[model samples]
Target: MRRIMLLLILYSSKASFSYWSRQMNGIRVSGWLVSCSYSHFTTSCH
Candidate 1:
C-alpha cells in the first residue's frame, strides 16, 4: 500500500511536469492531468 501510494505520487508529479513542458505527446499529457485531478478529488471527497 505504501509503495503504491509512493508510485502514484511520483507518476503524478512526472505527469504534471510533462504537461507544463508541452511535450508533443498530446493525448497522454491531457490524460495525466485529468487523472491527477480525478485522484485528488476522490481522495479529498473520501
Candidate 2:
C-alpha cells in the first residue's frame, strides 16, 4: 500500500513539474519576442 501511494505521488509531482516547466517556457519565449520587437522598433526610429 505504501509503495503504491509513493508511486502515485511521484507520478503526480512529475506531471505537474512538466506542465509548469512548459508554461514557463512559453512565457519566456513570448518575453523574448517582445523584447526583440521593441529593440527593432527603437533602432529603426533612431
Candidate 3:
C-alpha cells in the first residue's frame, strides 16, 4: 500500500513538472520572438 502511494506521488510530481516546464518554454520562446521583432522594427525605423 505504501509503495503504491509513493509511486502515485512520484508520477504526479513528474507530470506536473513536465507541464510547467513546457509552459515556461513556450513563454520564453514567445518573449524572445517579440524582442527580436521589436529590435528589428526599431533598427528599420532609424
Candidate 4:
C-alpha cells in the first residue's frame, strides 16, 4: 500500500510538471504571435 501511494505521488508530480510545461509553451507562442501582430499593425499604419 505504501509503495502504491509513493508511486501515485511521483506520477502525479510528473503529470503536473508536464502540464505546466505545455502551458508555458502555449504562453510563449501566444506572446510571440501578439508581438508579431503588433509589429504588422504598426507597419501597416505608417
Candidate 5:
C-alpha cells in the first residue's frame, strides 16, 4: 500500500511539473513576441 501511494504521488507531481513548465514557456514566448512587435512598430513609425 505504501509503495502504491508513493508511485501515485510521484506520477502526479511529474505530470504537474510538465504542465507548469509548458505554461511558463508559453508566457515567455508571448512576452518575447510582444516586445518584438513593439520594436518593429516603433522602427516603422520613425
Candidate 6:
C-alpha cells in the first residue's frame, strides 16, 4: 500500500514537470520566431 502511494506521487510529479517544461519550450520557440521575423522585417526595410 505504501509502495503504491509512492508510485502515484512520483508519477504525478513527473507528469506535471514534463507538462511545464513543454509549455516553457513552446513559449521560448515562439518568442525566438517572433524576434527573428521582427529583425528580418526591420533589416529589409532599411
Strongest candidate by TM-score: 2
- Per-residue lDDT tens digits for candidate 1, residues 1-46, read 9999999999998989977666656767778787888988767522
The segments of candidate 3 whose C-alpha lies over 4 angstroms from its true place after superposition are 1-11, 44-46
lDDT of 6 at 32: 84
Query: After TM-score superposition, what is the CA distance of residue 9 in candidate 1 from its true location, in Å?
Result: 0.3
The all-Cα superposition gives candidate 1 an RMSD in Å to the true structure of 15.2
For each candidate, the alpha-carbon lDDT, in order, equals 0.79, 0.89, 0.89, 0.88, 0.89, 0.89
Clashes of 3: 0
| lDDT of model 2 at position 37 | 83
lDDT of 2 at 20: 90
lDDT of 6 at 46: 25
Query: What does candidate 5 score on TM?
Result: 0.58
Question: Ten consecutive residues with minimal summed lDDT in candidate 3?
Answer: 37-46
lDDT of 4: 0.88
lDDT tens readout by residue for model 5, 1-46: 9999999999999999989999999999998888888988777522
Clashing pairs in 4: none
RMSD over all Cα atoms, model 6: 4.3
Query: How do the predictions measure up, each by TM-score?
Result: 0.39, 0.61, 0.60, 0.59, 0.58, 0.59
List where candidate 5 sits over 4 angstroms from the true fold: 1-11, 44-46
User: In model 6, where do residues sit more than 4 Å from their true spots?
Assistant: 1-11, 44-46
Q: Which of 3 and 5 is ahead in TM-score?
A: 3
Candidate 4 lDDT over residue span 1-46, tens digit each:
9999999999999989989999999999999888888988777522
